[model samples]
Target: MKKDLNGKITRGTQRTLDAFFDAMTALLQTKPFADISVNELCERAGYPRATFYNYFEDRDDLLTYCWIALSQRADSADLASVESSRRVDVALDAMADLLESNTAMLHAVLAHNPPDGPLFASLHRFIEHNARQLMLTCVDRDRFDLPADLIADHYANTLLLVLDWAYLRGHTLTRAQLHDYVHTLLRGVE
Candidate 1:
């Protein structure tokens, strides 16, 4: 949603955005994005194809927007505030919560195609960015054998794999289990 002179989203625009994401989420559950046509999306959302184009550059743009709508960035834990031992937990749990909350979207976006698509890369960057931020804020760099960036990448990629597994498992996994697994992975799982 773009801001006007006042930089605020009108309720009408907000509702349209909501309908678009909701429609995408529902469609993602049934088919791969490659197979879903724009017409299908517009039909599901009860919007005209012209309206879809007006709001999104293309299907990929719509997919990216759907993910953003699912998760917000500012919710990242203040590493300066959370305990060091718990800082990792806080960040990982917040991510796990986001995964659980957006299970269908995550699945749709990360479907077993190549992991090299623009949107997939964007998803990777999103995870790595959050991991890198938390690692820099909470880690004692002097204690690590590798660079923080490397460590964060390891953690982020592993977490993505775990999230994919959880999604495939029908989300039967508990959040507590997710916490333990990611903690081990974050610690480099030696």
Candidate 2:
């Protein structure tokens, strides 16, 4: 569902998108991403195959869109005015909340897709790409000694590592602790 000229997702489009997302999330809970099919998604979403194709190219495309949409919702904070050192803290808090809220789906998904699995690799790449873009926008280039791209990559890698530890490695830290640890780790970088 593409946005209109106002760049807002219309209610109808949002409903359609949410249905697909819910279907994808539910499917991921029961099986590996590879096992999911476009027809199955359409069946679960209560939409026709043509309707599914209207919004996405394939199941993989739907999966990617799911993460992108979820992350965009998580990143709703207006960080332009936030202090550079504190922005990541806020962002991590949002992400941690997102993870916590989707615990059931995540637990199920993680069970089938370990750190070395394709699903994890796909998510990692997606987050890294978005995180790098975010870092460039939020951080002041003059403050970092490293090149902007390098700094962005460093931050993205660090965020991914912390996320892996928090979620994929037995949940040693609570969501709050995860947020705090990431906040501390990123504080000195700015």
| Residue pairs whose backbone atoms clash in candidate 1 | none
Per-candidate total of colliding backbone pairs: 0, 0
Among all windows of 10 consecutive residues in model 2, the one with the lowest summed lDDT is 1-10
Candidate with best TM-score: 2
lDDT of 2 by residue, 109-180 (tens): 878767778787888888888878876677678787878888777777777778878877765786667777
Clashes by residue pair, model 2:
none
TM-scores across all candidates? 0.71, 0.86
lDDT of 2: 0.78
- Tens digit per residue, CA lDDT, model 1, 49-108: 988887888887787777666567336777768876676667767777777666665666
lDDT of each: 0.69, 0.78
- Supply candidate 1's per-residue lDDT for 47: 95
